[model samples]
Target chain A: MTQATRVHVAVPNAPYDVHVGEGVLQGIAAATAGADRVAVVSDREVCALHGDLRRHGVDAPMLEFDGGESIKTLGVLEEVLDFCAASSLSRSSILVAYGGGTVGDLTGMAASLFKRGLRVIQVPTTLLAQVDASVGGKTAINLAAGKNLAGTFHQPHAVFCDTGLLGTLSEAEYQSGLGEVIKTALIEGEPALAQLESISRDLGARAVTALSDTVARCVTTKARVVVSDPEERGARRSLNLGHTFAHAIEHAAGYGRVPHGIAVAVGLQLAASASERVYASSTDLGERIGRLLSAFGLPADLEELRSRYSLGAALTANALIEGLGHDKKGRVGAPEFVLMRGPGDIELGVMIAEEELRDLLA
Target chain B: MTQATRVHVAVPNAPYDVHVGEGVLQGIAAATAGADRVAVVSDREVCALHGDLRRHGVDAPMLEFDGGESIKTLGVLEEVLDFCAASSLSRSSILVAYGGGTVGDLTGMAASLFKRGLRVIQVPTTLLAQVDASVGGKTAINLAAGKNLAGTFHQPHAVFCDTGLLGTLSEAEYQSGLGEVIKTALIEGEPALAQLESISRDLGARAVTALSDTVARCVTTKARVVVSDPEERGARRSLNLGHTFAHAIEHAAGYGRVPHGIAVAVGLQLAASASERVYASSTDLGERIGRLLSAFGLPADLEELRSRYSLGAALTANALIEGLGHDKKGRVGAPEFVLMRGPGDIELGVMIAEEELRDLLA
Candidate 1:
């Protein structure tokens, strides 16, 4: 029997399996064996790269649209639904999203709302998707108001990621993958992060292995958190460590201008700095994290470059405040931010003073 | 102290709370208290009857659309999303569905997809919705091919049923409510079903008290099963007792033409008759059920209606076959209809032959 690495993501109802390996795309047919019809929702980039998956025994109709982070909007979802209706796809059918984070988020959501709900499988082509977006089942899209402003915690039936596809990504895209890998490392611990760092020298062989392993590791950490609090009411709030700051940067920079991982890279650094300044987390460790982010060719000084953003500080503050307000963690009142004391240690409902936050504004 | 009755529905992750009483519309404000914005997905009927819920201290932006079962299609959902976007509603916004089953189903689905998943509250108007549709976590809409073909099992945060609304329904609509009531009676057995027969004379009074009580009792039964299998893989199959035949009939006749409850009444009688014929169930009980359904002015015979339905044997056969295939109970193979031996005693996986099904077709 072939060795198939299985990553079980603990969602609310059941543990969903994520399979990552060589030629895993071929396994899409088997992963959704029971579904009578399969509608593959892919962007133009993925379709062009994969050479028309409908030709490859996918055995279902294909719905292709313009590919990009910008496509992950409610408008795109409407288009996808129209496609499903025009194709006569029913709830019994399965939807396979064949692309990166944006595609995964948008397609997962489209499949979710098609008939109220349906089964979806993620065929993540990007390294960022394989490690992060595809595993947790947080399907969503960006609106004009904010990034990931619309989404659901819908776990896919299965995720099939072929690491061979990573070879096709540009160096900038590959570095973006490392950004998430580092985020997982900082939160998860030194061991996984260190292992990924050591392999970064060789982008071809060792980097792919490191990326795949890190994806698995991040997924494991996320699955454990999700299983405990699938709705993010309690302990799962830690997963949003850098996301608050990240959302601010993404919105300020304008959507699609800031790649998610790059923005997250900056956000993670800011979070580390905040932990040090506000909560007395290890400043040295924060600097070490800063070094790793910069070493990975990501934006390490976003807090310092606050003036570069087009949006106002008050606007950024409100947007982040509004985003946090919508979060499931803010069940009580005036959504609280999670601050860290150190690695593996967190304080929930930590009120960050507006004066202190303003002082830290570069 | 206010005598606030909060019913806990046992669903996976977070079991929902159901509130029943007068001025429950006011309770909706409390449920969505902390939301940044509120989006109400209602139809014309509920808005007209409730007199623009916005007037009742619902300051949130409302998305009003066409009412009825037909509007539960994909096209309507797209329109709803467009409405949400145009209104500048963000992911943190609260979505409240105000109406009967169709409204609840469509809104629940819209919430599930909008921003991946948004918080949803159900304010059911009709009798069928208050007791049955709103209480259970099942949310779905009909497709061109089948009934409830596209959907999800999303439980709302809370449900409010104002018994006063049932006052406006026509006599035909009132009889339609009995269809589900009778179904619950059959599933719950002697105590629940016998209690039902007692209140048969004073249905109007009992509907406000005992009818809601019976529906809640049925909800309790299904809730227990749902807790074990939120995804509807195991014991949850029992709830689909009369649904298979009901779905077929509803699709055969135009959806709104034959009310859901009317189809269910006919379907339940047919199921009983089929059980007696195929699985050695009680012929006496089956006849009694037919009598009860007929007394309520439900359609017990389909011979005269056959020509009008345009239901070919092949269509019926495929519809039944495909419908069963979608049933979570039929995981191992072809879905078998649940045949009852008596009032409460149910037999699982009774594969009825097509010849026998054709023989019992009336």
Candidate 2:
């Protein structure tokens, strides 16, 4: 809490800051000085837990929504839009998202949509968001068909990730967030992979030092990739390592039932196995990912996840595979994936054969 | 039909060409040569009138929606998204919006939101969409509370304006588009204003040469302004010249009843009147605008429109005045007006006092 960790993501069109520390609300107040109107949007839980944003001195209206994964829908988006209109929120108005990734996603999309976009200050309050959502400008909601099927790339004006917000997160949420941290560690390579591999256990326990540093590291890693490819056309997809399989798992689980991090953790295993078969190497990459996930209380085995979710039948596996093809990241009839070559090297846009993928699924 | 007029809009972030001609469907085919997937989105009316896009040699799926004004809602947006998902429309898909501004607006927004945006080709059949909506990248849907309360600025990859399509447009719809063409001409200052004024009479009769040239000219004028300021940070506000007052008129008429172009036509006179009252000049700008509008079979007098829409007393005028204060372009208290000093000359962001504005309303 004494030291502040800051990361800057240069999206070219919209560069923003990601701050990790305690008592950072005052910093946000200073950044949004000349704004005509300031509005804070958050979920009901976060609003109740954090109280009103007015506590920071800059007075503004607090907009709250209820529900979890269900909130990421067009119906809910309209509700937020209606709230803005009722409050007379204009282009000059500033919107500060005061919750997790879902809140950030919904608010960011609203900011990008309302009058083509308003300046949004992302105040992500969850470990999952602090590392991932708060850094990249990807904002979206779930379509009835799938998660994040409907969305836009809208970068926030600034992202204030107060690590103090992590103290209140339940054990399950914190563990779920570790899935993304592990993904970042694995993708970044070398020093980070070695460092994370060493202290994966302590970080799972929410040790202040480990948690803050890991958060800053993940943000920094993602920022470097995002700055180079803001629109997800190239290197940015590396950030989605194991996400193709993960999206299918979430889709099959009916979204939120298996939290995003859990799905991603499971996705990394599938990706590792696919990598093992494709690369024709027995590098123990899958085994290392399994060990790291286990230390964090995450399910890493494909069989274990399938059993937990009752996903055994060929039909179910085929359906999940179908979801992968439907993912936004891939071109039609050309399903590509992000896979790990070894401990620290992640390869992007590796085309996977359908039958080969089927053999792995089986 | 032989010679196509091309206007290139330099958006810096994403530049595009606006091609105008009678038989330019072949040009559209050439533009979309290597696209992975081509899809046409339109209302049933356009689909029926235009027959099919296959005549241009590019066969693609046609997505349709029913209803008017009301179609520009979240319910419809979700439907279009569902269509994209069903069609497996991914990041590589090319969406051709082959209808009026509403279709272009809705489809452009869908393209922008679908996987954070796809390459959109705007084939504006209606004049309004051709000159304004398709050119500036301004996409929005009317909120129940207000018009364009929720929207985004997503530019199309290309725009094709087929003058031949105007053959099928109802007279009301065609004339309705003139409001925008007039607004652009007034703002462009010069030859555009003089040229439009000269051909005002024949153009009203659907003169092909006049319509095509005016369409090309208007597109060029808007492109110049958009290139300088793509996000409406400055000069782009001039495009909304007659739009502020027009929004109030449409809102009063319950939208679609008065028609956007008629309201804009009425809005122009109000803007001209306000300009006279504010500038304290002896310029004959208002009279020239009136003369031009009259030749096009448009009502040139404010009293004529007020009578037509049955707007009377201080209450209705005051209500619209209030709506101006709420405009996204100007600040909450001080509403700015875009006015013209003379032919080929415009004064943008002209702030008017509430009392003086009331005098015009009175």
Question: Best-fitting candidate, measured by DockQ?
Answer: 2
TM-score of chain B of each: 0.87, 0.95
Work out candidate 2's RMSD over C-alphas: 1.9
Q: In angstroms, how far off is B245's CA in candidate 1?
A: 2.0
DockQ of each: 0.25, 0.74
lDDT at residue B260 of model 2 (Cα atoms): 83
Model 2 ranges with Cα > 4 A deviation: A309-315, B311-315
lDDT of 2 by residue, A1-362 (tens): 45588888878866888888776666888877878877878777876787767767768777887636878989889988877776677788888888888999999898888877888999888898998987788899988777898888888888887777788888778877898998998888868878998888778877777878888899999899989888888889998888988888777666777778878888898999999888988877788888988898888776777776676652266877877776778887677899888766878889888888888766
Candidate 2 chain A — worst ten consecutive residues by lDDT sum? A308-317
Q: What TM-score does each of the candidates earn?
A: 0.80, 0.97
Per-model TM-score (chain A alone): 0.88, 0.95
Residue B43 C-alpha lDDT in model 1: 68
What DockQ does candidate 1 score?
0.25
User: Which pairs of residues collide in model 2?
Assistant: A116-B152, B189-B344, B190-B344
lDDT (tens digit, per residue) of candidate 1 on B70-91:
7787667656655565555554
How does each model score on lDDT?
0.68, 0.81
